[model samples]
Structure formats: structure tokens, C-alpha cells
Target: MSKITSIATAVPVYQQSQMQIYDAVRAVHAGTEEEARVLRFMYKSSGIETRYAAVPDFNLENGRNEILHIDGADINTSGLEDRLKIYDKAALDLSIDVIRKCLHEYMNPSDITHLITVSCTGMQAPGLDLSIVKELKLCPNIYRTSVNFMGCYAAIHGLKHAHYIAEKEPDAKVLVVCVELCTLHFQKDRSIDNITSTVIFGDGAAAVLVENSGSKRAGWELKKFYSEINFEGIDDMAWKISKDGFLMTLTNKVPEILEKKCKDIMDHALQYYGITSEAVDSWCVHPGGKKILEAVERGSSVTREQLQESYAVLKEYGNMSSPTVLFVLEKILRRAEQNGSVKNIVGMAFGPGLTLETFHLANA
Candidate 1:
């Protein structure tokens, strides 16, 4: 069975409080007092304390804004090209940092047999995958795969691919990296969807090393993964490219839909391992947002305490899209290590297509 041997996460240098981000968003999109009040309310209740960004545009204190502004004026009209230009550099830098952390003292870059890069925030031909190989001096012939535009659940798909490769080749050591610059796609519209997306999304990267053979150290053994798409809610959560950075449509109905369907998905995924929710020791759920986490808790057998790590990650980093779930899992892994306990871990993440992805893991 494939096991996750190491996991590391990194965020950009510029950090801003939720209020700072609110101020930036209001400056860009709020056109009236009522709009600013609504934004204030949303940011206040977002359950996020702070978030990181690749650009200093959101850092009001530093006062060095480029992409979101021009010559001390609020541009609020950055084209997709402009946003991607920032993404191209920032994404690579963050990915390399997280990869170095993931590989430190764990394995050599030359030992990686397969490389999987996951992202929905940015895309290019000589994409992050090739960049990672060249930067780390990984095997020139290492199998490379890119899982792009899958949104938050893409990392699980990457891990699932790693699991498959390890099953097929026992000597495989797969490296999975998920880096998202969600802030780069921040929209300057007053729509509720855009406002909500802007309020929650942040920038970060995470990497995990999955190996076929078990090591003497503690790690999570991959067990089973199940996925389902709720076609009816397809429009509720979506990402589309536009003249102005990628547009995100996130409606309130997303949490409602998950609240109704989360339990069944968890049950179905857990059934594969002959275990029930009661037997699981930890729940490494994706903190898509406060509402999302609350919905999962209400719909599943897990309690708020079981979801502490998810809430902590959300509070600390907001939503970093594809890497958010891994951040949650990494916290649980660290806690288990410190406590010297084996854990039965269940992870879940959601994305466009209103897709639900769940996985079961146990300590090896």
C-alpha cells in the first residue's frame, strides 16, 4: 500500500489580517456605503484571522502595490495576463520552497520516480511540473503528470494517482505538489460570489511524498478513495477563465448541498475499509470555509473537536484551494506523531462540479 511519508506546506511572504484583506477588497469592489458594510460583515464572519498573498498589493501598510493598483491608483482591472504573469513566478517559488521542506531529511530529489503537480489557479505549457523537475534536479526521465483546473479536490486526485503508481510499481517514490495562488484570481466585482471568494481564498503550496514501501517512521497508509459529483449543484461552484483573471462562482447553496450529502459520502468511503465513523480517530476535512466546515460537522458523525485541525488551518491560512486539505492532514499527522498514537484518518475535499472527494488512511 502506498503511504504518505512526509508533508510540508508554505505560503508567500506577504501576510495580511482578514480585516486588511477586507479593506483591500472594499477598496477595489465596494462602490457604496451599503456595499462596504456588507463586505465588512462577510469578512468579520469569515472565521479567518489571517491570510497570505504572493503579492504585496493586499498589504496596505507596506504601500508597494503593483498588480492591483497602478501609480497610487486602484486599477482593479488587472487582465488575466497580468495575473498569470505574477502566478508564473510566485507559484514556482512557493512550490520549490514547500518541496524542499517535504524532501529535507526524508529523501533525495534524485530518488523521486514520479512527479505530480496539482493546481487550478494557474496554467502554462512549460508548467509547474517541468519547472519543479528542473529546479530540484529530479530524474530527467521521471514520469510527470499535471492535474490542472480540478480546483480544491485536485490534490486528492494527485494522491490517488500516486497510490495507483505505487500499487503498480512497488519501488515507486512519488512526489505530489499542490500550489495555488487563489488571490491572483481575485475578482473586482460586487457580486456576492466574487465577494465571498475574495474573502476566503488565499495563497499557499503543499507537498507530500508517497512511497510504496512502509518505513520505520510513522506515516499514513493509503486505503481507499471515493468521489462523487453532484450535477445539480454544478453552477453553485465553478471556475472559469475570463478577460479579468479566472472567475469563481461560489454560492451559499454549496454548503447546503454538502450538508445534505456529506454523511452519505463519508459512510460510503468508510465502508470500504470495514469501519464506521465511530472508529475513525481523526477527520482531516478541507476547510473550504466556515460554513463548509460547519455543514460537514452537522452532516457527519464527527464533532467540532475532531475538526479542530481543519478549523485551525482555515483560521491561520484561510482557503488555499488545492493545498488546504493537505495542510489539515499535515496538522493531524504532526499531532499523532507527538502523541505517539496511531490514527484512523478520514479526509474530504470539495471543488467545482460540486464534486465530493473522500479518502481513508490509517497509521502504518
Candidate 2:
């Protein structure tokens, strides 16, 4: 059977407080009144009281002068590539570090045969997978795959790929790593959406080891997965190329759309698991943002308290893209062992392709 051996996670050292994030977003606004309005609404609605960015002293008023301007004169993207180097390297280092820790704890570094990485915030060549292989001294024969530009739900995509290999290859050992530097996608526009992005996104990475071994399962197992892409939303929540930089268009209707389509998605997922919603004793939800989470909670028909760990992760780390799910999964795993007899966990993520990736996870 395929079972998750262990999981580990990491966050960049560069950190910023919630108020700092608010202030930074404020600096991105185009006018004074608009700035106040944007910051107020973002702070009130985010459900996030704090966050960690990949860059130290990251602020819209990035200049050494630290002066605030209504026209966003202080905002600059000139050094973005330089900063990307730092964020990507730190994120990659943390990913390899966590995997090394997991390997040392449960198996030898030489045992891993595959590596899968997930990210939506940034991309680079000789990418994170090769970097991890070289840094950790894993077997050169190991295979690698990267799932990028998929937004918050990316970890699900990565897991789906790993599950495919584990189900097919005997004794295949796969390591899934997710790292996002959401702060790197920061936009200087004073728009409410931009401010909302600033308020909700954070920087972090996570690593998990899954292996198919000829022994009784001791951890969670992947049961089934489903993906849905609604073409109608292609332009709604897009991450794309532009002269300025990558632009994120998170439509205002995301929550509404999720609320509307959730019934069918939930029904389908439950059917895939051969169980009803009420039978699900535990939920490992992706806390993309406060409103997004609320939409999911409403759709799943799960109580607010049932998703407290997810909410807590949002409050502490904001949304760390793909790794955020693992943050919540860690809590659920602990909860399952505490409660006992808990057998099922449902995981989900949403991204471009206007896609929804859903899974039925069981205690292995």
C-alpha cells in the first residue's frame, strides 16, 4: 500500500507583521482616500491578522527614503529579479532542508526515487527539483516534475502526480515539495483587488514523503482525485505575462462562483469517496483567504470549528500557496491520532484552467 511516511515544512526568514502588510498595501494605493478605503476593507475582510513575506523590509515604499506617496511614486520593480534570486534560493533551501529531515527520520536519502514540486508564485530554470537533488545528494536516477502557475491549489496537483506514480510503481518513493514567494507577485496598483492580494498572500514551503511499501499502511493514503476546469472563468482568476510583470486577476465573483458550483463539486467528490458529507469526521481545507475559506466551509456544510486549524494557518501564515494545505494537514493528522478511528480526509485546491483539484485522503 502507498502511505505517507512523514511531512515537514519551512518558511522564509524574511518576515513582516500584519500592520506592515497593511502599510505596504497602503503605499500601493493611488490616492489618499482610496488608500484608506482599500487598507480598511482588506484588513477587515482578510481574516488574517499577520503574514510572513519572503523579503525583509518589503514595503511598497521600498526606497531608502521610506516616504509615502499617493501616486505610488515609491513603488518600483527594478530590483524584482534580484529579489527573486534571494526568495527562490531561500525557498529552495528550505524545501531541501525539510526533505532531508524527513528522509533522515523515516528512510535513507538514497531511498527516494522521485521528486515532485509545486509552485504558483515564481519560476526559474535548472529549477527547484534539480536544486533539491544536488543539495540532498539523492540518487541520480530519480525522476522529477514541477507543477507551476496553478495558484493556491497547486499542492493537490502535485499530490495527484505523486499518487499516480505510487499506484503504478512498486516500492516507489516520492517526495512532494511546495514553495511559494507570494510576496514576489506584489503589485503597486491602488486597486482593492491588489490590496486584497497583498493582505492574504505569504511565503512558505512544505515537504512530504510518500512510499509504496509491502507492509500494512501506517499513515494517510490517497484514494481518488477529480479535476474540474470551468472555461467561463479563464479570464477571471488569471496569472499571466505583462510588460510590468505577472498580473493576478482574482475576480470578485470567486466566492460567489464557488458557492454556486460547490454543491455539484461536493456531491461528486462524496460520490467518488463512496460516502456522504456527514460521514466526513475530519476536513483538511485550503485556506486561500478568509472569504475563499468561508465559501468552502459553506459549500462543504462543515462547521466553522471543524476548520479551525485551517483558519489558524491563514491567520498565522496568510496563504502560502500550495504549502498551505500541508499546514492544515499537519493539524488534521494530529487531530486524527487524538480522536482515533478517524479514517478519511478531504483535500482541495483551486487555480488556473479555472480549475478545481479535489481528493479523498485516508489514514494509511
Candidate 3:
């Protein structure tokens, strides 16, 4: 069976703590004492204790007209093409760095025959794909493809793509990278939707290398993949390239959808293993956000304790789009290695398309 061999990931060095984010908002609109106080607890109410900002200072005031700069978008979004350009480069650089680490740890760059990239936050043709090939001096003719604007579950699609390649050619080695400069997509406005969206997302990337039956890192065999959509919630989450940058729509009704669907999805994902929800070894669920996590927990009854790792990632880095599942999966992998136990990973993520994606993995 084709197996996932190794994964590497990186975040941009620049970042803004949630507290700093809160203070910046308050400082920009500190007209009254009560307004300042409300800003202080914005992070707390946001259900996000931390998020990474691509800009070191992230000038919250730039987005605010009179103290309502929200979302993590650029101060001036008019030059949409130009603004998205630089951040995409930075994300590409970090993505290449991660691929380098994973390559060095697992195989030589020369060994890779396929490259796949996944992202929702930015898009550029001949982007990271060509850059990675040239920088690493890989085969000039290496096959390259990218999955864009697919939201958080993009990684699953990337993996599925890799699985198809490996199955077709058993010796194939694939590099799949998921990168998002979320801060770059923030809307520079005071709309509550933008503000709430800002609070839940951050910038990050993850790179993974998987080989087909190779004498290298051995773990996480590709078993089967599953997916479905909540057709009614199609408009619930989406990204529009607006004049202001990218407008994010996240409705409050999202949790209700998760509560309604997660059980069936989770049950379906585990059936092949002859396992019930309670019998699974571990969960590597995407921590979409605070309420989503809480809603998923209640819907699946997976136990609050079962989700500590997911919550910690949310608290530490906010949601890093598609790469969010990597954080969760990596954490579980590390824990299993520490305990010296056979590891079985049930990795899952949710995204636009109003969908759920699940994977079954185990140490090879």
C-alpha cells in the first residue's frame, strides 16, 4: 500500500500575539474608556487566544477607519494584485523551507517526481510550483500541480492526488505543501463579520513528503478517503476577491451544521476499520475554531479531553487554513512516538463546499 513517509512545515517568522491584536484595536479607537476595556477582552471573546500575523506589527490601525479595522487584511487593499504578491512570496519561501527540511530528513530533492501545492489564501500561476523546482534544482521536467481556493480540506485533496500518483507508479515520491497567508486576506473594515473572521485565522504553512513503498521514513499508510457536503450551507463560508481584498463570510449558523452532520461523517469514516467512535485510537481533527470544536465535541461526544491538542493549536496559532490539520496530525504523531506505541491516526478537516474530509492513517 502507498504510505505517507514524512512531513515538514513552517510558519512565517513575523507574528502578532492576540493580546497585541486586541491592544491595537483599542488604541486605534480609544475614544472612550469603555471601548478600551472592550478591546482588552476582544481576544477572550474571540475564542482565539493567539494568532500569527505576517506583518510584525500588523498595524491594526491601518485597517480601521476610526477604530474598527478588522479582519487581518492589508491597510490599503486597493492594490489587490500588488498586496497579494509579496505575501504570496513570503508564504512560498516558508513553504520551500519546510519542503527542504522534509526532503533532507527523508529523501533528496532529486528523488521527487511529483509536486502538489494546496492553498486558499493566495493564488499565482507559475508560483511556488516553478520557484520550488528551480530553487531546489530538481528535475526541470518534474510534474507540478496546485490546488487553490479549496479552503481547509485542501490537504486532503493534495494527499488524494499523491495517492493517485503513487498507485499509478509505485516508485513515485511526492511533495505536497499547504500554505496560507491568512493575515493577507483580512478585510480592512469594521464590519462584525470581518472582525470575527480576523479573530479566527492566522498565517502558516506545512510541507509533507510521501514515497511509495520506499526504504525511508515509514508511517501513515494511505488507506481510504471519505468526503461529503452539507449542500444547504454552501454560502456559509466563502472567500471573494473584493476591492477591499478578500471578503470572508462566516455565519453564526455554522455550528448548527456541524452539530447536525459530524456524527454521520465520523461514523462513516471509521466503519472500514471495524471500529466505533469510542474504539478509535486517536483523533487528528481540524480545529476550525472555538465554537466549531465545541460543537463537534458535543455532536460526536468525543470528549473535551480528546480535543486538548486541537484547542492548544487554536490557542497558540489560531487557524492556519488547510495546514491546520497538519498541526493536529503532527501533535498526535509526536505523542505516539513518545509513548513508543503503534500509532493509528484518524485525520480529518472541514472547509468550504460546506464539507467534511477524513483520512485513515497508521505507522507503516
Q: How many clashes show up in model 1?
A: 0
Task: Give the alpha carbon lDDT tens digit for every residue of 1-364 in model 1.
Answer: 7889899999999999999987766767777899788889989998999999998887678787656763444455678998899998899999999999999997789999999999999999898899888988999999999999999999999999999998678788899999999988776666888888888999999999988755454567998888988887899999999988899988999999999998988878878768977889999899999999999888877899999999999999999999999999999998998995646998899999989888888877
lDDT, model 1, position 158: 96
lDDT of each: 0.89, 0.75, 0.75
Give the Å error, residue 20, model 1: 1.0
Predicted candidate 2 versus true structure: per-residue lDDT over 1-364, tens digit per residue: 4667687777876566677666655555536786587566767677877676666545544443211224436456534465456656777777876677666657777788899988776678988888888887889988989998888788888888887888788778898998887777676765656666767888888888876744344678888888788776777787775544456778778877787776688788889779888777777778878888788777768779878888999988888878999888877887778878578877777876578888887766
Displacement of the residue 345 alpha carbon in candidate 2, Å: 0.8
**Residue runs of model 2 more than 4 Å from their true location after superposition:** 59-73, 213-217
Each prediction's RMSD to truth: 1.5, 2.9, 3.7
Residue pairs in steric clash, candidate 2?
A: 219-364, 220-364
| Tens digits of per-residue lDDT for model 3, 1-364 | 6787787667877566787776665543344688667656666765666676655445454443321233544333334675577666787688877888777756689889999988877777667788778878889889999998888888988988888787678778888988888777656556656767767788888877766755356667877788888887789977778655677887887888998889888888889655666655778888888888898888886877777778888888888989888877777777777895635667778888798888887777
User: Residue 67 of model 3: what lDDT?
Assistant: 16
**In model 1, what lDDT does residue 176 have?**
96
By summed lDDT, the worst window of 10 consecutive residues in model 2 runs over 63-72
Better of 1 and 2 by lDDT: 1
Find the candidate with the highest TM-score and give its number.
1
